[model samples]
Target: MIIRPRPHWIHLLFVRRGSLLPRILSQQIFVLLLSCAVVVVHGQLFHWKVTLTSAPFSLMGVALAIFLGFRINASYDRYWEARRLWGTVLIEGRNLARHALTLTGGGVDARPFVLGLIAFAMAMRNQFRGRPRQEGLEGLLPAETVARVQAARCAPALILLWLGQWLQGVREAGHLSPMLAQHMERSVDELSAALGGCERIANTPLPFTYTVILHRSSYLYCMMLPFGLVDTIGWMTPLVVGFVSYTFFALEALSDEIEEPFGTMPNDLALDAIVAGIEASLRELLGETPAPAPQPDAAFILN
Candidate 1:
């Protein structure tokens, strides 16, 4: 996610963004240097040669690769599920706003109110991620509702409360019939469900013990690898261990970074941009002017 122009020294920086390759390599280099220093000082390091066909390492390497692959795949599955839930939010959001406009039969001002409700969904999405956009949100809501919603810890819940109030008011004003009100309420319920699903995915992570096991095993394997190979490879053991460790650590770290897609990490699903897209769609459905454009930073990585 850190986009530095390709380093002039290397033709390709591996094209593997968001990986821990750099950090892993740096750590391995440090350890290798320390080991080299110790061996140089002892002068008895030549006796430590290891066999290339060591059964333990070969078997362990195969098992380790399989585990790392499984972990990465599972992490990606979680990330994608979060995205799919949000995608449902986007679709339902547009439908909700449309339902309000067509089903409510309120006047011109009411259409803006409906558009505002759509904006609230976007604001709530951002708020859940601990990123409330000050300008966009404040510009979208009634001052009193905004103040009250801001005061509350749960922004999405506040949005639902306000939405319920709006629907009730319209129903009372004779703009929305009982049947239409019921239909709109169903849309709100769907939105609420989407919110709950997102929260569940964000809150319930892969088990701590499982994550710890993989992480600990990865480092332990890398550490022991050099020791086992020191007799045969000498100083070259470090280079080999460094490369192998970099691959393992890079995959694990990348998976961890993206596991919680609601987070602010670069690889996290772009909830803000996605919400903005939903807002734009809703506004277009309502035929409103002054609709905000989709995010300019959509080019940034979100996968």
Candidate 2:
């Protein structure tokens, strides 16, 4: 996502890289022009004056602001939960890697097991973003394992299955006791739960009808605002309408951008960076040299 040092107050007002202004600029301009036209005509249409008062708009604005607040809160909840689930994945992946190295009695090669944890994280990232499984798995996993994951309907779930099989094989080979294997198995189960949580959030979004109603209401309120203020504010009606419309439009766009936290939007969670960090941490746990951490782009977007 947009990761950068906070800008100065004046720069904050004019910053365009991560702002939502670009997405709603056209709408704001249209509303400003409409407001200007209404003011020029003195709130008249076809020789008939459209009389309106600010009192109703004041009440509607209050209600609309409250509803928009609720919508944004709901979207932020999803975004935060998704981030927490990834945090769980990172933690559990580290735990599994440590277990693979220490608890296997040094008789079993832990590289494959550690690599499986990384593969699971990559597969989950790809699945959430609707990408193909083979993008980065060829180098991390065996060809047969990658083939199995690619062919499976759920690549992350399949990788988890392979992980379980590895634990079982280690136990059977006398490299690990049954109790220790079960302990590592619990970490794998935690990874599974995290995977399922991410799946639920990705598959089930906020209801479409709710989004439609909120979108229509925001536009309707902005479009009808100029007439209400024209009679009272006179020449300043366009300026007032422009500012108000910008607030409503920007909030609506922000909600839409963050509703699906796994997306490639500037505001969405940085799944690419998150997956890379997980891989790096796991490799470090295995005493291997991890790759460099991902750097943000020139625009300060990490994904």
Candidate 3:
């Protein structure tokens, strides 16, 4: 997901950050010790030695490669599903705010309602990441309503509740007709569906048994690899095994990081940016003198 080329030393540092370094290095050390033992024992046993087989490499290599492929494929599916759901949320949020503002002929103060929609988007993003909703809702919500929504267990639902109440209030004040209220309520329903889709992706994951099996099998294969190659390749086994282990294990860690895209990861969904965009769009609709600019990244990254 990081598109630009990194400097050589920086890329080297990332090898440790990949989460596979500890396991791979531990396995490598164990293999080195085992190789030393074999050399020592063979010298004592009248120059007898055991060489690893290339046949198992050919067969198990194909099988293990296939398993890793399947695991990556499943993880990508989950990542893409999360992205699609959030994209739907962005669209539905704009529609809800637009409906509330224009549906009443722009007579009432739609700024609060429009800001509420933006706040809802940020709240949903924070909810998924298990973060506190303190910052993003500031300009986008009334003080009293923001406090209430912050105290509520489900932030998205609380935002929807506020939207419903506002629509009801508009009707009571003879600002909007019941028919328009119904139409606005249907728009809220679409936003709710988008929230539900997001929750579905977060709650359900690929089967636990399958994930455990792949991880266990991968570790076993990695542990056995140096032993299988040592007799022939000798010290060269470390370099080869290290490179191969890095590839497989790095991919595994990358998949885990991206599988849930709402988190505070490098390749996560740009929720902050997206919510800021919604605010800009709504403020433009309100005919504000100076519409707020898009959220700027701090050092090329959103905090």
Candidate 4:
């Protein structure tokens, strides 16, 4: 997502990054052209007045806006929940690194466990965006371990399982106490919960039927809107309809993008940066320098 600070109030009028303008511009142009035609014809077909009243449209607009409001609310809930789950990942990752190293009393090399945490975050990020790249794992895991996970189903879960077994092995080797291992296991479980929560959001979406209904209704209302206004507004119908169409189209596009917060869109969550931050935190515990900072694209999006 775009990572820059909020623009100044005056500059906010001209904001582009994360703006809804790009997606809706074409549709708005079409609606505007349609409005112009409706104005030229004045809702008349073959000289028969296709009289349409603004009263019905005004009432319908209120109802449609309410439904759109509900959809936007639902989408924002998903977006916020995704953010919170990642926040959990960050906190739990840092905690795991500290607890694992300290409780092991330097008797065990913590690199493997630390790498497991990083791997889980990277794998989860890849799963969310459907961009599967394995280069990030080379620094964190051995070739053999990476090769084994590359073929596994739910690679993150599998890597976590290996970490659990590693902890068990350390316990057997007389490094970690059973209690410390159990505590570490709970952190892993919370990580699992966070992952499961994100998967739920990513895999599940707003119902298809609702989307269909909303889309058709929006188009119908916008197209028919000029008919309702052409008689009353006359030559100015295009300008007025264009402004109204912009609102409806922009809101709809915004809702669609934010509904799935894990995408590479400007408004979507910055999973790459979040994963990088997790890697940096874990690597620090391993006495490694921080990961290089993530830079935003020309649109100021950190995908």
Candidate 5:
């Protein structure tokens, strides 16, 4: 997602990167042309005057706007919740890494378990995006462990499993106490819950029918809008309709982008940045001087 400080008021008015303008430009153009055609034909498709009037459109348009508002609200709820879940990810990752480091006390080799935490973050990010397993972990983990986790159906879950086994072995070897092990177990459980929460949002979207209805209603309203206003607005129907069409089209497009917050869209959650932060912070806790943090794109987008 685009991560930048706020801009000036004038810049906000014209800012294009984080806005829905890019996605809805084609739709806006189509609506503008449709409005122009209605104006040319004088709101009459053939010779029929289209039989559409301002009264019904005004009533229907209000209802449609309300419906669109609800859709945007729902999408924002999903977006905000996804963000909170990932916040939990960051907190719990730090907790896990710190606990493991202290438990090992520079004797039991904490790097492997720390490496598992890093792998879990990477795997979870890829899983949320529905991408295949990632590479580049051969140097951090044993080749066999890396290969096994990557080949698993859910790579993040597999990494957690390996971490659990390591924890159990440490306890059995009398290196870690049961109470501290249980604390680590609780942190791992929280990690698993965070994963499940992300999966829920990624897999379960707003119903298809709801989107279909909203899309059809938006298009119909925008198309017939000119016909309704052509009588009162006269030659200015195209200009007025263009502005109104932009509002509705932009809302619809924004709703679609934010509804699924785990994707690589400009407005989706910044999984890449979040994962990088987790990796770097965990390594620092393990007393390893890591490289610089991740950087955003030219547009300040993290993903």
Candidate 6:
């Protein structure tokens, strides 16, 4: 996701990196050219003067803006919900690492449990981003464990199973008492719930019909806007249409990008950085030097 510092107002007006302008530029240009043609023809088609007025467009624009606002709010809700789920994953991961280190008796190596948490986070990220299940698991987990996770249909769920098994082994070996094991198991359950939440969001998107209706409405409104305004605004129709179309197009594009927060879009969630942070926190809890935190790229984007 875009992670740059806020810029000055003047620079912000021209900023391209994280803005929806790039995505909607083509639509904006098309609307501008269409408006120019309408103005040139004086809102006529085949020698027939198309009698139109801005009254209908004004009313329609208001309704369209309201619907676009609603769509954007819905998309943002999904994005924020995904971020909260990842936050829970991080918190529960840290809790699990701490329980493995302090709650368990001595000589119980907590590294494996902590590593499993890291692997789980990676698996979730890969699953959401539609990447290979075993893309980044080799160095984080044992060969056998990696193979098991790779083989499983749900890699994150399998890693959670392994984590539960590790806790059970600790309890069986007398390192973790039953009570403490149950307490730690609560964290595991929380992790499971968080993973389930992410999966739900990833699987169920905003209704396809709703999106299709909005998409068609936005484009149709822009396409016909020039005819409505050409007679009223004359040569200024193109400029007005360009500005209005840009607003509508940009909003639609922004909503599309953020609707699926797990995507690789510039506006999507920073899954790689989030998983890395979780790994660092768990490793630090285990008394190991955490890897350096991820930095945004030259364009100030963290994937």
lDDT-better candidate, 2 vs 4: 2
How many clashes would you count in candidate 6? 0
Candidate 4 local Cα displacement, residue 193, angstroms: 1.2
Better of 1 and 3 by TM-score: 1
What lDDT does each candidate get? 0.70, 0.88, 0.71, 0.85, 0.84, 0.88
RMSD of each: 4.4, 1.9, 4.7, 2.3, 2.4, 2.0
Residue lDDT tens for model 2, 1-303: 765666667767777765888899999989999998998899999999888889999999999999999999999999999999999999988888888888787758899988888999899888888899866887778899998888888998888988899888888989999998899888889998988898888889999998899999999998889889987889999999888998999999999889999998878999988999999998888788988887545464221
Best by TM-score: 2
| Per-residue C-alpha lDDT of model 1 across residues 84-151, encoded as one tens digit per residue | 88877777777777677666664724664565666566665666577754336666777887787667
Give the clash count for each candidate. 5, 0, 0, 0, 0, 0
Candidate 3 segments exceeding 4 Å error:
1-51, 171-180, 288-303
Q: Please, what is the TM-score per model?
A: 0.80, 0.96, 0.77, 0.93, 0.92, 0.95
lDDT of 3 by residue, 1-303 (tens): 222234356555554432445535665566456546544453233454445565797688789889888888888887887777777777777777777777775468888888788778888878887888655788777788789877888889888888889889988888888998897788888788878888887888777888788778767776667667766676676677667666767666666666776776655566666666666766676776435655333332211
Instruction: Please provide, for model 5 over 146-252, each residue's C-alpha lDDT reduced to its tens digit, 9 standing for 90 to 100.
Output: 88877888888888888899999988888889999999999999989988998888889999999999999999888888988887888898898888888888898
| Candidate 4 structure quality by residue, lDDT tens digits, 3-71 | 776556776777766788878888988998889888887798788888889999999999999989998
lDDT of 6 by residue, 26-136 (tens): 888788888888988899999998888899998999999999999999999999999999999999888888878888899988888888899999999999998989988
Please give the ranking of all candidate structures by TM-score, highest first, separated by commas: 2, 6, 4, 5, 1, 3
Clashing pairs in 1: 48-231, 49-231, 49-232, 50-231, 50-232
On lDDT, who's better, 3 or 6? Answer: 6
| Model 6 pairs whose backbones collide | none
- Segments in model 4 whose C-alpha atoms lie over 4 Å from true places: 295-303
- Considering TM-score, which of the candidate structures 3 and 4 is the better prediction for this target? 4
lDDT of 6: 0.88
Give the CA lDDT, 0 to 100, for residue 184 in model 3: 76
